[model samples]
Target: MTSIPPTDFRSFLSSVGRVFAVFFRQGRKARRTRFFFLFSFLPVAVSLVIKFNQVFSGKPGREGGYLFTNLIMLFYLQMIILILALFYGTSVCSEELEGKTLAYLITRPIPKAAIVLGKYAAYMAVMTGMVILGLIFSFFVLNVDRLLDPSLYGLLGRYLGVLILGLMAYGAFFTFLGSSLKRSIFFGLLFSFGWENVIQYFPGSTQRLAIAHYLKSFLPATSSGRFSFLTFRLEPTKPGLALLMLFAIAAAFLALACLFFSKKEYSLED
Candidate 1:
């Protein structure tokens, strides 16, 4: 694409469109796609095995609801969601850099931040679709008996909204790490499973420092002992404030990622 006038709003959008188109098309072939595709089906596999035990005993009980909610939350919120966002988000820039393709993109006439925005949007699209499909299939497998329940669909929608929001907040923050750190996944793990997990247990307002604090506020408090750590000694932020804070966190990290990408001199060697 030729260089459009930098001040032209329509032209800038057109540039973003072109970058988004290129990235979205190629993103499917990424290894994360295949890995997460299997990872998403995990709950389905677990649900089937557990449910089958009940069936083989000729005692198909009402345990599906508890099993579904428990397994899904444990797998996705505690594990898959964070890992998905970590790998894909940090790879936003790192992938191109390691592949030595960043030069080709930077050489284009488009604004550098447009590269970040376009690629971020494209990755989000791919990740969201994959995770949701997994969530849906697992939901169906676990809750096949309740398919017609009106409230079940509403509950599904709530889970979808929360997962997507978590992806955005976590993905953007890790994208910043990708832009700034060569070994971002290490720190991503530390932050996601360590600080984010541990900080929520701290008393008073100090728990608010972790991103999980805001995301967990949107989820219902569970009574299960396994996940009591999530709700134990926690202060819930209002949903409105939590939503706003998540958006703010995403925006701030994304902005910094863009800024650093635009200013820093990255080399194929580095």
Candidate 2:
């Protein structure tokens, strides 16, 4: 009878540790990662400066209106998540292939799925952290008087939840694209700024295809009034339906990402 060597739990944990260490080390060397953080914060900073000026000018109502509008637009949140997810998702596997380092990792006694999942988890963590930091800054700027209306707080909470779901869905979608395309970044940008933005204006069921539609539905109706021209100009979904749609989109995209990554042959010199 052939005897199998005992699988050591400690060894498994050590391997996981090494995976994270490698991820962080590579992150430090990736200038794009640093630039992502910088660009993510810039819009939030600009919005805050404008809000402060409004507040000091005895225009608190205007300041509140701007805060409500900016939060609904969530330009900083959406753009940062989309950019990070596109670059990080595609680059995680693509970079390894480019540097010829993927072979070494795959040669180890680790599942390819683990490599993909670990990298995905790390990217999400970094992107989420950047977004939450921006949210905190926005909150401080908007709420300097520390006065909170229950309705406003509730709207903020709903928007935050929707933002999180948007990240998950967009991240998974771009991650799948990264696995499938050599020039995923360019295409990802086009889909984000072009297709999604364009399609949301289409009538009825067509608009439902875009995640942004459901996300906007989750914001307060008063907030929606601010961007009525850009939105579908339809009634916002009920909270329950909006949440369901967001989660459904995330799940569908993640499944597609996993399917592609599991079957595709990743090549270095594409």
Candidate 3:
């Protein structure tokens, strides 16, 4: 029996460290990262202003303030996540191809899956950070004059879970697209605006084809009473089913992305 050398452990740790280091360094260097932070925070700021004005005026009853606030915040946050994920996910592998740096990275002993996972982990960290910041900001805006209701906290927990699931699903789908197509940006834009927008409004089970349907179901109806016309159109699903569908969509997309990434040929010449 051949004995493995002690150096193997050291090598493994070193490789793991390198993966994180590379992911952070490359992610920071990407130009769109600034835009990611900016867009992510802007909505939170605007919500704060709106909430402050309402609280001072003592006129929060008109538009279902609570519900409208929650929906708008969540909607904007989801949009930011989707857009950023599409940009970052595609750029992770696609940028390497464009720069002709992939060959050098692949030459390292590190598995390609590790590279993908490492970048994905880093991207998610950034995304989650943005969401948390937005959440905190929104909380302050919403609860500055009053205590948060315990029930609202529970609802927030549910919303956060769904937000994460939505991110994973969108991220994996875009990563696969980015890896497979040189024109991923155009196609991703179309899917976000054209496909998702259209499918969300379709009647009945047809809406199930879009991830947004499951997400909207997880959200509590707007409470502000102002945006009655914009309340969630679809009937809410049981929490278990909503969660299951979200995870299922995320898992399927992530698996497909991994499969495509593992076998696809990436070239700078494209």
Candidate 4:
């Protein structure tokens, strides 16, 4: 049996810290890093349209309110988080490769896992920050009158938690694709809109295979449209099971990413 090296918490923490610094500096220097702006502001643009439509069409009272609020959650997941995660997540390793810095990082004493994880941590920071900001913006735009209501805060908290979980799950999967495949973004797009969106709508147990399926299961059933884009009823999974599945998906993909990044021979030409 291979003997594992003794664990050192201090060393691990130091490596993580170093990786964070490098990725953040790289992010700052990357001129094309408009993802932050695009992700942060796109929700505002959408909310403006929705707000106006709601004003003209009249308020969706009570149950309509539930559908509208939950639709925002679904829209945020499908549109904002899905696109942002695909673009940025798939760029985690590819960006380094493009800059020709990945080779240098590999040669250093830092563990490859640490580097992969560090980059993921940095990605999480930026993605989560933008998502939270977008959520707040959308909330205010759509619910300006309800903003001061104390009950809305609790609902916001729940939605934010689910959004973050969805981000982490999708982020890890796309990050893995970036590390493992040459043309990750193209495939990621196909999988996001093509596979995930389509599969989740399929009736019966097959829908459970998609990450979005589990996410939808976490939505409160107070609204008829909480988990469905159409009139088709959604199969509900236990909240605990859904949450567990999300964490599992995130952990599984992240592990694959680390393993692939540590072993692969990446070309710097891209």
Candidate 5:
């Protein structure tokens, strides 16, 4: 049974803690969880294929850094991160609405913001765990020979940091949309696949409007060294600016999501 806590700072924290644990355990049994676990390892398959092909051609060497930057990073930053954020992030509220459980949720004594905050934190933990495990295994497959190199670990650390920031920003933005918009999934697809992909490649400062632009700023290089022109970045945002902008985006969206969730009324029929 759900705990009924009075609205206060301590009660709010208690609400968030309880909901976090409950939702986290629920998420484990979710089909989305299984999908993410499987999706995370997809890159490992590609890594093996590439490694075998390189070895057969007599061009194999410990080029994990280059391979990651040129090939795998694109698969990750452009595709995997976006998919994860969109699928899981938007589900925070959408799932409740679809399951017809939001009514029961809001009627409880717990603060509404706590529901959003708790669920967001729970999803973050799940996404992070899946992403970290998948990315680490993928990196291992790519850099099998360089596991002892200290620099390799640093590279992995930087990559993880950048990707996590991407998840946080994208996830929060989608969570806000999910709570506010009726057709958030449609808009999310447009935003993720349409706006993000195209805007980053646009000419001039217009490209700066894209979240991908800021993300690419922190990436050491573009998609592929040879075909880098495909996803070129003429003037990437500064690392400091990227950090600021991403954090600001996440915080702003989360605040909006919480506010909207707290105030908006939903009917059982709607």
Candidate 6:
């Protein structure tokens, strides 16, 4: 197989580093954009409210624990990842265009692939931090007693792993959308809430095309009657295959983003 020259590889690495550094310094833009920080904090806030009400009402603790975990892990946590990934991923390159900085960024001594990939890396890093903080807040606000249980911590770790996998997949897909489409957010929303939500319920191989299909396969099976509406009939995929699917999806989308970015022209006029 042909291999890249060492000098070329080193230059690509350096370009990646430079792009990462610039975006890393500008990471605060994520929080400032349309009150994203508040949206990120929302899961914890709702959990806290529920926890306090349970304590004040002297409700039974067992049921409350279940509610906290479900809300944090299934509802709030997933919502945060989906929403933030869509917003951040779809805006990564578009923001530069909006700020009239695309010309400056593109003119730099960097490979086009490095520019797209670097912004992708920076976006993932920022999302990772936000998701971790949200998880921690939900954990503590639910109750400090959970920290005493080693099994609970182990479970949380697994759940976090699944969430991160989902983030990487969804983030890359939306980033590809942003790079390729002018009205990406609108379509992204449709895919997340409309297509991903409904298509899994379809019969046969048709459902497999959606990202959420693989994600659901990675989650521990639940007899959550409260969320029966969200359940779809499908054989669970092995964890290894599910993880691989997410990685493959992310790689494919990011590669497409790089290809599109390299070919498309950006301008202040648009």
lDDT winner: 1
Model 2, span 1-270: residue lDDT tens: 965355755555556566667786676567877888787776577667777687677765545545645542556444666777778877766777677887788888865655665666677767777776776666656666655656656655665676676777777777777767778889999988888777777787778777777777775555344444545454566778977877777566656666676678876675
Q: How displaced is residue 228 in candidate 5, in Å?
A: 2.2
lDDT of 5: 0.83
Tell me the tens digit of each residue's lDDT in model 6 across 42-140: 878888887788788887554534655566666643477888889888877777777787888788889888988888888788887778777778777
Ranking by TM-score: 1, 6, 5, 4, 3, 2
- Cα deviation at 72, candidate 6, in Å, is 1.9
Off by over 4 Å in 2: 1-30, 55-61, 148-151, 223-226
lDDT of each: 0.84, 0.68, 0.69, 0.78, 0.83, 0.77
Candidate maximizing TM-score: 1
Q: Per-residue CA lDDT of candidate 5, range 15-81, in tens? A: 9998899889888778879988888777778888988877788986648767766667777788888
Model 3: per-residue Cα lDDT over 1-270, one tens digit each: 997587975665566567768787766666676777777777667666677677778886433236324544555534777787788777767777888888888898976766776676677667776666666566556665554456656655665666676677777778778777889989998888788777876787887887777777766665445443333466566768977887787667666666676788765675
Candidate 2 residue pairs in backbone clash: none
TM-scores for all candidates: the values are: 0.92, 0.81, 0.82, 0.86, 0.91, 0.91
Per-residue lDDT tens digits for candidate 4, residues 61-180, read: 433235346566766877778887887788888777876878788889898888888888787777787788877787778777677778777877888888898889999999999999
Span of ten consecutive residues with least summed lDDT in model 4 = 222-231
lDDT order of candidates, top first: 1, 5, 4, 6, 3, 2
| Worst window of 10 by summed lDDT in candidate 5 | 221-230
* Tens digits of lDDT, candidate 1, 1-270: 887576687877778788889888888877768888888778778878777777788887655556656668778888888998998899888888898989889888999888987888888888898889888887888887778878878778888888899999999999999999988999999999899889977888999998878878887777665656657776889999999999999999999999988898887884
- Off by more than 4 A, model 6: 29-34, 61-65, 76-78, 228-230
Ten consecutive residues with minimal summed lDDT in candidate 1?
61-70
Off by over 4 Å in 3: 1-21, 28-31, 55-71, 222-231
Inter-residue clash pairs, candidate 4: none
